[model samples]
Target: MATLKEFEDALREHGMNMALALLERLRERDRATRTVKPARRLTGQKMTPELARAILDLHATTGMTQQEIAFKVGVNQGRVNEVIKRGKWLTDDPQAPEAVARDKAKARLRGEPKPKKAAVKEKKVAPRRTNQGQLALGDL
Candidate 1:
């Protein structure tokens, strides 16, 4: 309950050491009475697509490694791969590459005119029994 003037007078009468001790106690009391919050975690939450694109672009163009960029962006280094490669691998959706590729093949087979379809159909049926001798992966 010491007033500022009283405290000042007391400090003058006492010593600097006593004043510093009192100041420390006052600071402690102030902290205890106040709703002091903890320091915030520096890890950011989310990165927008534009930010992700920028980060991946920076990784692709700069000397800095993906790990360093991921850390800066508050994401895993693998996310750098996903971001750069698109969601092709990391995606869990059922409509991914395998399904889409199947759909495309089906479409290509069904899209051509009836004559070509009939020809391809006959070839598929009359094939030499082995999938060999065709334009395979090497042709691709």
Candidate 2:
């Protein structure tokens, strides 16, 4: 890839000073579009029973906002509201008792044990490298 210096040199040679203004305008448009978009979607992590109880207690006793509870519990505010409304940590609609029983029976017939919570893995970021193949100290 051409370096920034090389790009600037090429622009100068071509007498394209107005191109810089166009580039700046394009960058501003990109930034504006990005800021106008909604926040990222929530990760599809299920709330544990203990977490649900904690959310309910916090809401009842302290009258904390759903967003606050969500921050404390590491979930989205919608999840906090859902748990408060349903009285359970469920990702979907509550099944009828008979339907639940039938599902359990089918699971047993298929020799499937109840699912357990999977551990959340932390993401590791690679160190940024410069064009010259040296570590980028700006990140540090």
Candidate 3:
């Protein structure tokens, strides 16, 4: 199937100026009628108590799904689920699991070195014996 651009090129090849002008006018009309919505936030907003409460209220009051709530609140759907199900981000406590995770993420984004855990010695395993040396019935 030929696209509009291809059709336009064909029309131009045939010197169909009137059709090309019509196509351009149609494109202008489409551009004029098209409504442009503000782009949704690509990065999630910082979760706060108020935002958590708002998420909860939206969940309780409306039939919005976790994804819809996340879109509305500019947060991850997982974050919305945490807020609704586990009551996460309801406080400003730095010790909270979500807060701690967020802090760790920010630290990672800033190129901070991760804390190393104590190294454990690996257990050595013996290699398995192959059947390459075994004589088969055909060989015998």
Q: Which is the leading candidate under TM-score?
A: 3
Task: Estimate the TM-score of every prediction.
Answer: 0.30, 0.36, 0.60
Q: Per-residue CA lDDT of candidate 2, range 1-140, in tens? A: 99866887788889998986777688799888885555454563456667778888899999689998888778888878878886655323348453476578889999999878899998998877666665677966
Q: Kindly give the stretch of ten consecutive residues in candidate 2 with the minimal lDDT sum.
A: 90-99
Tens-place lDDT per residue, model 3, 1-140, is 99878999999999999999999999999999999786788677988999999999999999999999999889989999988889998999999988899899999999999989899999998888785597789997
Full-model lDDT for every candidate:
0.67, 0.75, 0.92
| All candidates in order of lDDT, best leading | 3, 2, 1
List the candidate 2 regions with Cα displacement exceeding 4 Å.
1-45, 90-140
Candidate 1 has an lDDT of 0.67
lDDT digits (tens) for residues 1-140 of candidate 1: 98987877777777777776788799899988999575443565354556666776787788888778877767677767667766433344457764466467777788854323334333355545675576777798
Clash count of each predicted structure: 0, 0, 0
